[model samples]
Target: MTPSNPDPDPYLTPGYRPGGATLPRETPPGETPPAEGGTSFTGPDDSHNPTDGWAAAPLTAVLVVAALVVAFFVAYAVWFVID
Candidate 1:
């Protein structure tokens, strides 16, 4: 007989937890981290992104902004003293 209150999902009941969501198996000895995004549910974390370590930070751009901020403060102080 079917359950009187049938759930929407046939494969997953209210309390079901899939094996893939369980903690990962330990690496035996000489193996690398488990495969990502193939048979496994998780892809590499952002640290493992394809673009990881691809570009240096744009220090010149940041320095330009920092210079502008310093100049603005200096000008404001000078004007305040002269006024």
Candidate 2:
């Protein structure tokens, strides 16, 4: 013979509770719930182009050249002092 199930419905069993707080169906004063089933988001139309600002290639080239000039001067000074 099959053993009888103590709690046939696990949901109805004692000490077996569902997670999360129980929220009220009623909306707060001066606020209304959405009529639609899913969410509808509205946002501003803005550009997200990363290359909108100053050109990175030109800036990087200028910085590299400046660094090389400074490095050359430092090497010349060290050589002059040693020689």
Candidate 3:
């Protein structure tokens, strides 16, 4: 039989076998994986979730209008007081 080449079978020949246990089958212990239905979803169900501090366009428009009104009144008061 031809010699078994060390290059072809490194693990079988000597001290080169893999060192650790096989990787975990499921997530490691205490890992609290996504809720338990094999569906694996972890967050709110809504697909179009709004961010915490984000506002929609209509709300932003209202805020801008209100700010402009307040600014106009403040500027009018300053002008009236000066004149």
Candidate 4:
């Protein structure tokens, strides 16, 4: 038979402390690290302004009122049919 393995299976390991250096080392002071693709949020301000257009509160209120009115009508119809 083959010699028994000393190290346990890495996949079967539990918790944060698996075996080796699983975490990234802290960046040095003043030195700018290279932009990590997708992970890094620091980039061109291409995001649209949230307050550029009409507020969502008005639209949400209108939708809520419409839904409430529809619900009331449905309840009324069901009550009428049952009566």
Candidate 5:
């Protein structure tokens, strides 16, 4: 009789398995993957859009007040130097 086979990788021999490993089932052509398996978005699509007016009003008011304070100081210094 001939010698028996020692290596049994499925890739090497079509009908053989090295240690009885199971292969994943094949998907049919043109079929979409199941909902739980498909790719998904991780965050909101409109995350860059501006917020509502109520949330932005306070920041606008603060910037306007800061600009007025700076303009007042600059005007006072110029007048004092010129007088």
Candidate 6:
């Protein structure tokens, strides 16, 4: 009996043994594995906004105007006041 050459025989191992019966299936090219971690669907909460309806707009406007008024008065006192 002749020994099977593993290099030329797909069914033979090195000396003369059969290889693994199941070969890996051929996967189509360009296919990637799924993402490891699950995806998330969320956004910032609406509580950050401190306004409601027309009242909210006017309230924000009033606060901005008040800040500007205070800034102008402070500048006048610091630079324009008689020394």
Q: Looking at model 3, which ten-residue stretch has the lowest summed lDDT? A: 8-17
List the candidate 4 regions with Cα displacement exceeding 4 Å. 1-53
Q: Which candidate achieves the best TM-score against the true structure?
A: 1
Question: Which tens-of-lDDT digit does each residue in 1-83 have in candidate 1?
Answer: 86577546634433334553323344233334445657555656566547544244576778789999999999999999999
Looking at model 1, the pairs that clash are none
lDDT for each residue of candidate 3 in 1-83, tens digit (9 for 90 to 100): 89775565544432333664344553345443455576568767887866686568878999999999999999999999999
Q: How much is the lDDT of residue 29 in candidate 2?
A: 40
Candidate 2 Cα outliers beyond 4 Å, as residue runs: 1-53
Task: Tell me, by lDDT, which candidate is best.
Answer: 4
Candidate-wise lDDT, in order = 0.61, 0.68, 0.67, 0.69, 0.67, 0.62
TM-score per candidate, chains pooled? 0.37, 0.36, 0.34, 0.36, 0.34, 0.31
Give the per-residue Cα lDDT of candidate 2 at 79: 100
Whichever of 1 and 5 has more lDDT, that candidate is: 5
Q: Give the per-residue lDDT of model 6 (tens digit) for 1-83.
A: 99775566543322332444443343333333555675453656667876556787788999999999999999889887775
Flag the better candidate by TM-score, 3 or 6: 3
* Residue 73, candidate 4: C-alpha displacement in angstroms: 0.3
Judged by lDDT against the true structure, how good is candidate 6? 0.62
For model 5, how does the per-residue alpha-carbon lDDT over 1-83 read when each residue is reduced to its tens digit? 99987867446533334566444433333343445744577557875867566666788899999999999999999999999
Q: Write one digit per residue (lDDT tens) for candidate 4, span 1-83.
A: 89999998756543324445443333233334556688467777777866666678988999899999999999999999999
RMSD for each model, in Å, please?
Answer: 12.8, 14.4, 15.4, 11.5, 12.5, 15.2
